[model samples]
Target: MINRRNMLRAGVVAAGVAGGVAVAAGPASAAASGKGWVSVLDHYRDAQGQERDDAGAIQAAINAATAMRPVHSVLVPPGEYVVNREILVSGLNDAVISGHGATLTLTGAAATTPGASAVLKITDSERFEVSGLTVVDNERTQPYNGVSIARSSRGTLNGVSVYGVKWTGLGVFDTTPGASTDIAIINCTAVGTRFGISTNGHDVRIIGNHVAMYWPSTAEAAAKGGVWSAPSDYYDGINVLTGSDRTTVTGNTITECGQAGVYTQDCTNLVVSANTVTGCQLRGIEVDGGSRVAVGVTVSGNTVVDCKGQINLVRARDVSVVGNRLANTSAARAASLIAVNVGSSHVSVVGNHATQAHPTFPAVYVIGDATDVTVAANEVVAGTPYQAPASVALLYRSAAGEFTVGGRLLATKGLGVGNAVAAATPGKVVSKIEVFSASGASLGFVPVYQSIA
Candidate 1:
């Protein structure tokens, strides 16, 4: 969150700027329109055609915005803009660039080149905005990143659509880690990219976006030796990683990503809630601690559907996965739908509903020396999209930790075992479910293998 002092500081822009015959002064169309505006056509009229590069004209419009006093907006209005070179918007204060009915097409020598491949970059600024733009690639043979925001603060991207990027569609970062604050990306659509949105800044909000087709095509995957993102495992739909603090990803419909739908790692205080995730090739939602283990993560109220691998928390701590709905989960790479593995601690998988589960594996699995994991009060239904036979158990904990499954269910028969429970409740794996004790003891018999469908 940016304070009042931060907002006031962002209002400072250098004065005494000018534009040429192709550009004009900005007009405040309404209360919603910005105080200052600069039209790119007023600066360079020949920039409208796709036959030539428009980077100079576009950059000039942005410069003119800052050159004007209290007029801080640039418009790439209602036309096609072809760019061969990268267009830069750098070192500004309190500015907006809107392109509601415009399209920016990138051509010639456009492909992923680490930090220099983005079509547009907003760097080293404060209180900046870019909204309502469409960015696409001209060459299907090669593509680059869509927009990159680096070392900026109090910035926003709203209602933007980006496609045909190979590396990252929308990326926000700071060279100095954790130095950025109060950035928001709202209602943006990213498609056909390796990573939809990758961020490592502070206090960022990624909300209400439609992101899909984030995996490489079959030919592209074969080109990488039958793997997805081999050199870099960053093909997720929305990635929050590395020094990101107070990040919130909510209310987005994410689909068909190669890695995970919403992936988080090496961050702090993340909240991934109310997102609909589906058709992911790997884990639907993964909180993997890649190097610097993420602390204070919460994944709640998301609907994960039919993903090959479901929600997994690997090497993370202080996490809560609650009130999530998982449906028709399929097992992939021998991992269950809900898995907490690899030395993860203080995790709670509580109050979740696993409906119509096709249990090729156990519905819930806590493995790999995980400690202090509680799988409680979950309603897990096996086999049957309400249709047929349900196989496998409700839970499996193969860890060396203190695990508890509260609410013992009612067994039809008294098949006594070493870790037997006095079956007293009714209606399936209800009240509580504990298949094995911490000391490798069986808690029940016949009903342990019984279908709760």
Candidate 2:
């Protein structure tokens, strides 16, 4: 068994070598065959002790461990180590870097490039695992990332805490499309960064993470005024960007971000489910396809509260937004609980509960040019209507066509007057169409034409 005392004694013996130099040990020195575990402190502590940069020692241990016929584990004991430069781990298969309550602090000049600026960069590796580590970059003036995994597949980053990064905290990126796959980022916490976690890989799972304080503002501004009152900047809790497909983001808590709590742009086959998002400056969850027509996205079983907009999908196809609880305590102005913008098709918004204190905007807003979209089984409660006519639950705007209400063709509109329904007079459109119970009491007004021309 490897305990602290034995490890410390071994480290003392390794430090006693002549010339006080760090050496990369061979396989013969390993404690076990085919399963080697190298302690960073035992083999690589600096001559000047904890006050000096021990990154070289850790890097040497990583290189030595990777050089073994079979890959091994690099154990980082509980201590504060400073790394002035990026630590690169490349081409290592089945390697594990396990930090047992270790904290790696980054200092000095920031690298101009993304790969160099990352505190720990892993490239061209497979089956790598990094867990139980705390990486901090407290220098706000410099751009840095906590971890960057590029061109790496089948990697797991678990139980890591990354904070105070100038740029993204954890980035899983690849140069080519679908180069990186099966990456799992689980139970991680990222705070006070510009972007919490950004991925450009396929089949990635971002589960049970807590991302917070991503708004770009000072503590004084947030304390005196609210987080929303500050000048907003672009930030996302978890961003699944282009080239990422079949990604899953579930059971995460994201709060106080400048942009969407969970955002997917130009990503296909994405799932954002069971997340708690609150106090976001922009939409809570957004699937935006910038002229590319993203397909097969699902946003379901999320709790979104106190956001500017709850859900927004733009130019996407074959999307499903279901079983989400959305609310806004503040008075509404122009945003809705759910907004399906133009060019989206084959969409389903079902079984959602939405409420707003001031009912200025519609609970669900479906814009023009969105085809094959269905909004059903949603319960919406709002206060008195503002400039709009009466309290209507659903608002839709489109060209004259056969419109369906409650799964039946209630009205067919003609092109004589742009707004005229076929069953109605030519120059005048149907307005304030209400749905009532069998008792003839008005349940509420269906979302008929409210100045939609």
Which numbered prediction scores highest in lDDT against the true structure? 2
After superposing candidate 2, which stretches have Cα over 4 Å from the reference?
A: 1-35, 45-52, 114-116, 214-217, 220-234, 332-334, 383-407, 410-453
Question: Which digits, one per residue and each the tens of the lDDT, describe model 1 over residues 1-453?
Answer: 221111211112222122111222343222222435665655554445432237667777777676666646786666577777678787656667777666788767444556456888888777777778888864644446788788888888888899876678898877666776778888999987778998999999999999997455556666786566655434689999888889999999998787789988888899999999987777889998888687898999999987765788888899999999987534344435677878687888878887544545666767747766767667666532111112212232224553332233334454322334445545453233345444445564444423645
Output candidate 2 Cα RMSD. 9.6
Which stretches of model 1 miss by more than 4 angstroms? 1-35, 45-52, 110-112, 140-143, 214-234, 329-335, 356-360, 383-453
| TM-score for each model | 0.74, 0.77
Model-by-model lDDT, in order? 0.70, 0.72
For model 1, give the 10-residue run with minimal summed lDDT.
384-393
